[model samples]
Target chain A: MSEVYAARRERLRERCAASGSATALVSRPANVRYLAGAAPRGAVLLLGRGTDLMVCAGPLGAHPDDDRPDEALRIQTLPGAADGRGDPAVAAADLAVADGAESLAVEEHHLTVARHRAIRSVTPRLRLTDLGGAVEQLRVIKDEEEISCLRIGAEIADQALSELLESILVGRTERHLALELERRLVDHGADGPAFATSVGTGPNSGRRGHRPTDRRVEEGDFLSVCLGATYRGYRCEIGRTFVIGTSPADWQIELYDLVFAAQRAGREALIPGAEYRDVDRAARQVLDSAGYGHGLSPLTGHGVGLEIDEDPQLAPAAMGKLDTCVPVTVEPGVHLPGRGGVRIDDTLVVRPEADGGPELLTITTKELLAL
Target chain B: MSEVYAARRERLRERCAASGSATALVSRPANVRYLAGAAPRGAVLLLGRGTDLMVCAGPLGAHPDDDRPDEALRIQTLPGAADGRGDPAVAAADLAVADGAESLAVEEHHLTVARHRAIRSVTPRLRLTDLGGAVEQLRVIKDEEEISCLRIGAEIADQALSELLESILVGRTERHLALELERRLVDHGADGPAFATSVGTGPNSGRRGHRPTDRRVEEGDFLSVCLGATYRGYRCEIGRTFVIGTSPADWQIELYDLVFAAQRAGREALIPGAEYRDVDRAARQVLDSAGYGHGLSPLTGHGVGLEIDEDPQLAPAAMGKLDTCVPVTVEPGVHLPGRGGVRIDDTLVVRPEADGGPELLTITTKELLAL
Candidate 1:
């Protein structure tokens, strides 16, 4: 495990060196964790110096869940700086310059302008460069160990959703249902919900990323739920829409079937060599032809990893090809303004045809059930 | 209500004009909400232009909890930009430059380097100046209406904590307790927990800002819980420690009393015109004299409002003085490593001697109860 982190840091160092930077400071929490194996909040990893240092503001206490840094790397605790209060990025930059690094690359997309300016002021002689999305690109493809975490997270999400289905959901507010799902996710061994558990019902149904509200579940209304779990820092999403009564209305059934078909098409298009935009188009065209494309979500789906949303976005303007072992969500939904709507989503990993088509991690049935 | 937001924006405009900035863009979500009365995610409020516009990425959906923008302010929804996806800061900058604003101010401390660069590229001729926490300064002395929201939020938090005290707590894990508290917060009319609820048990107890873990409660263990609720965009925090068994150990009782005294001192120091450092000192001196100051937390407490952690931090190096109506938490804790510890926190509003030294919002008792 330690070697894995060391190798990741080596790869990042190679990338930085190729870009003419002698040192790279990873301030983004996820990026720091990817390279250092553990990212205590406000901890930063400075690479390419004689010894890769994980600069933290204070001692990592009895935090069982905090990722442990690679044992081989040196850890520097800045006691003068208050625990969890000072900016570790600025401290890391000062250390990098003091360690004789001439050029340092930082994530411009993550660091605020004020912090970046502070870094420049502290190291007037050191040249600063942008390390734009380089680490994010590296995180796109996952190893089997990473995939197993995702698989476990998906299973937890599935168990939670299944339990919600078995219980009484009628007359429950969207907020309560969402909270229950989150609690169930934790009960089933997830760190927490990968993101806010979204439970949209009645007029709120089928909306992409709709925040749970106080609206109650009612008969003949569409009830859509989207939730995910975080296991060992990996995240996976699953969304399903169900009718609230004994039988669905004609419009509800039609909307559910249309979304299911779009989601299936999107899932089927997840081949290793497929373009991201093409996969998005495969699902989006189904809804477009059905005349519900005008207010469609910006993206059909998005990549998921340590972060709930990452790269390789499945959108019309996305520029990239799907790679093997890249986990992504293929969610498509259509919501009519005053009426209800439908959404079906699943997390799957892109795989070669020789092994299998896209390997579905979130296997919760998409069948529109009348609860 | 609309006039209140308009008046706030006018005050900001005056501040920016004094600083030689003809126009100002508020990209920080809390600041945007403060000035515009609503901050749809990814929205920005541009002041000093003929019409102060709340530029949002898309139409505000049927989100009842979302703050309604001041009626006097015109809302410009860019339908082309996906909901909550586009950078309204860049759009606002483009608008400002096109409207012939020669100079514009922005919250450099909040904007990322990439975003600041994007704004510069889009408006090359516009002189970008640092807003420099001006809005935050304005927010420091909150109005009575804002204080009322905090008061309600504190009441909700107190209710949630009281309910938890009645439940059995001999064997529950910290994570479950934290989640239950959050569920209860929503049940009591909170939009949500202001921040992640912290429930540290036994050795993990009394740690400031400790993330909840899976450690279960045991007899004689110290249990510390910190939680808050967000009501109408205002947030408040309250923390307390209790003994798990019917009787506490001698050491536990002493630690609890010492922490209680310290917390009381800090709370009592929250009068108007009190230096922030003096307030912190009032708390620190109590624990320091008892030989437990070596590993004390950085700050005694901090302000809470639209955001859980805000300005006027009560730390040794802080430079501000408390003003009337400024609500802040005076939390003091001592963690003894392998053994447990105690923390007492309360949110109170500073007041003058004529009106009452300070107003306590959270009414949760400070008595160290042995459950």
Candidate 2:
């Protein structure tokens, strides 16, 4: 694992060298974690020129030695770290200047203008270049270890959802159900929820990213839940909509079938060489022709890993093609204003045609389930 | 309430005008919320040049109407909002340009370099000026209404913590306890926890922002728990340390008293006209004299409101002063590396001596309990 992180840093270093940067500072947490193995609170990764350094303000967040960075990376806790006052990015810049580096590349997309100005003020003589989405691009494809973590996270999410289905759900508030799902996710060995658990019932169902409310579930109401787990550092998402009564109504079944088909289309389109937009269109078109075009979310689904939303967004405007080992979510839904709707989502890894195709990670059933 | 939001926006608009800007864009969520009752997901508040607009990507997060922005602020959901595709800030900048504004002030501290660059690209003719924490400065002194929310939130937190103390805690893991406390916070009507709940046991106790571990509670161990609740967008924090089982070691009692005294000093120093650093020094000097000076967190406490950690940081180097209605936490602790330590924290609102000194919001007992 240490070697893996070191190699990752080495690759980034090579990229920086080719880009005319003497050093590179990764201020983005996920990018730092990708190259350093673990990112402590306010930690930043400095790559290039001398020895690689992971400068942290203090100890790691919540979990300590359990998520230690690569052994190969030199951990530099800022002086007076007891107060946790230092910005690791500025410290990295100071180290760069002290090491006599000429230029440093930084993530312009991540660092705020104020922090960027502070960094420049710290190293007035050094030329700071834009690292852009270099690390994000590097993280698009994953190794087996990364995929395994995502798989575990998906399994945890599935377990949490499965447990929710077994027990009584009607008459329960959306907020309570969301909280229960989150607790279950943690119980099943997740660091925490990949994101806030979304539970919508009745009128709120099928709404994308709907915040759980105190609205209680009632008979004949559609219950839509979107949840994910963070295993180790990787994240995966799974969403399912079920009816609250003994049997789903005609509209509920029809809506569920439409959304399930759209989701399946998006999932099936996740081939290694599939264009990101093409995959989105595969799912989007299913609902578009059915007169539900105006009610769709921007994207059909999005890539997930370290962060729940990553690169290779499966949206109409998204560019680039899928690559093997690239994990993404294929979610599609349609919501009516007054009445409820349906959404079926799944996380899958893009695989080649010869290797069976896209590997579905979130294996929760899409078939309409009635509580 | 709508008038209150309008007045806040007017104040900010005047500040921007005084700074020689035609319009101001608030991209920071808290600042937006402060000015516009509720800030929807990916929303930005554009003040001045014309009617204030709260441009949002889509609907409000989770709860819609319950947390809607001020009615006076016109909300413009982006054209393709169904997919949540638009960046509200960029749309805001475009609005500024369309409104014939010659200069636009933006929160440079909140906007990323890439985002700032994108805004410049969109409106090259418009002079882009740095707003630079103008809204945050305005938010420093809370209104009676804002303080009321904080008071309610504090009550919720105190209730949650008090409930946790009554439950049997021995043999329970720090993570489970932390989760349980969070659930209780929600059960007691908190929108959610203000921040991640911190539960430390044994050697982990007394550490600032300690992440809960699987370590179980045992006899003769020091236990520190820090939790907060978010109610009506206001947040409050409270932390207390207790000795596990029916007895405590001499070192534990001694450390707990020291932290308690330091915390009290800090709370007492929260007068309306006191310097922020002086309030910190009040708590810090106590621990400093006890040979635990070097191990203190950057600040003895910090102001809390819409965000858990806000401005008016009570740190040694922080430049600010306590003002009436400003809510802050006075937390102080000492940690023994191998053995458990103690931390005591409370949230209080600064008031004039005439108003009966500092108004403590968290009313939980500070005395060490052997639970």
Candidate 3:
């Protein structure tokens, strides 16, 4: 594992050298974790011309899930800096200059203007270049190990959701339901939820990133929930909408069927070389033709890995094509104001036709379940 | 409530006018929420010359926990824009210029250089000045209503921590304990945890912000737990440590005594008009004189309200004075390498000595409990 991280850093070093940068400072937490194997809070990794240093402000505590750094990387805890204070990015720049490096590349997007100014002030003679989203672009595709983590996370989410279905949920509040699902996720060995557990009920259901409220679930309410689990820093998502009673009404079944068909179309479109927009269109056109176009969310689904929402966004204006080994979610929903709606989401990995097209990670049944 | 938001915006307008800037762009989420009552994802509040507009890339849906915006402020949701594309800060600047504002103040510390350049390009006729934590400074010394929220959040945290202490915690993993505590926080009416829950056992105890792991509790292990709850947007913190066996060892007793004494001294020092450094020294010197100087966390405590860690930081070199009604956490701990340690933390409001200085919000017992 240490060798993998070191090799990734070496590849990044090679790219920087080709660009004429003497050194590189990785400030973004995910990127730092990708190349350094560990990302302690307020820690920065400096890929100097000779040695690599992980400068941290706080104690080098270990997370239960992630990989620890190998012995090759030097870990230096800075003096006098507290947890969440004293920008480590500036310290990296200062270290670069002290090492006699003439040029440095920083992640301009993540560093604020004030911190950038401070870095420049400390090393006035050093030339700074934009690293842009180089690390993010590097992380678009995943190794088999990374995919394994996401796969397990998806399974945990599936188990949690399935358990919630078997239990009685009609009278519970959205907040309690969300909390219970989160607890179940942990019980199933997930490090935590990929993001905040979203539980939207009735008119609130099927909304993107809906926060749970104290509103009780009524008999005819549309209870839509979107949740995911994080396993070893990798995240996967699953969303489903259900009716609160023994039998869903005609309108409820119709809405659920519409969303289910749209979600199926999106999943079917996930091929090795399919364009991201094409996948989105497969899902979005169904809802749009049904006259639910105006209030649609920006994206149908997004790539999921280290970050819950990553690149390869499935939207109308999004560019780029899906590749084998890339994991993504295809979620589509339509919400009718005053009334309610349905949302169905699943996490899948893009694969070749020879490999059964897309590998569905979240294997929960799409059939609407009534509590 | 709407009038209060409007009045806060009016005060900010007055400040901008005196600085010779006719408008201000608030890009920071907390700042936007402070003035506009609600800040949707990727939303920016523009205090225009004639009107205020929340510039967002999409329609503002109902957020789960945050308060909705006042009807007085106009919401301008952009159409056809890609999700997560187009900076709202730049859009706010363009709106300000279109509204015929001559100058604009931007949060330089929050906005990136790329967005700053785009803002400059869109409004070439306008002069941009640094807003520079101006909104954060305004947020300092919160109103009575805001303090009430913090008080309630503190109570929720207290309830969660107390419940965890009564459970059979001798053999549970640190990760499970942390998750259970967070679930209880929501059960007690917190929107969610103010921050991630931390549970440390054995050598990991007493460390500030220690991430919970899979380590199971053992006999004679010193178990320390820190947790918080966020009510509305107000956040408060509480931390306590306990002995695992029937009775604590002599080392555990001594360490707990030292930390308790330091935390009390820090709370007593939180008088109105007292220097921030004085309050930190009141607690820090106790730990320093005990020959545990080098490894202590930099700041004894920090202000807590809408944000867990806000202004009025109590540190050795920190500048500024403690103002009345500014709630803060006075947490001080020492961790031994091989042997475990103790950490005691609480939330208290700064008050005048004549009026019973420092109102404690976290009422959990500080005694070394043997579970």
| Candidate achieving the largest TM-score | 1
Question: Share of real interface contacts recovered by each model?
Answer: 0.76, 0.80, 0.69
Q: Chain A TM-scores, all candidates? A: 0.98, 0.97, 0.96
Better of 1 and 2 by DockQ: 1
RMSD vs true structure, all candidates: 1.4, 1.9, 2.1
lDDT of 3 at B125: 86
| lDDT-better candidate, 2 vs 3 | 2
Native contacts present in candidate 1, fraction: 0.76
TM-score of chain B of each: 0.97, 0.97, 0.97
lDDT per residue for candidate 1 within A1-371, as digits (tens), equals 98888888888888888989979989899988888777887788889657999888877766666668888888888885762356788888888888888889999999999999998998889899999989999999998989999999999999999999999988899999999999999999999999999999988888887888888898888999999999988889999999988978888888888999999999999998899999999999999999998988888999999999999889988888999999999999998987868889899999899997899998888887899
**lDDT of candidate 2?**
0.88
lDDT of 2 at B208: 83
Candidate-wise lDDT, in order:
0.90, 0.88, 0.87
Indicate the worst ten consecutive residues by lDDT in candidate 3 chain A.
A58-67
Off by over 4 Å in 1: A83-86, B83-86
Candidate 3 Cα deviation (angstroms), residue B268: 1.1
Q: What is the lDDT of residue B126 in candidate 3?
A: 86
**DockQ (CA atoms), all models:** 0.68, 0.65, 0.61
Candidates sorted by DockQ, best first: 1, 2, 3
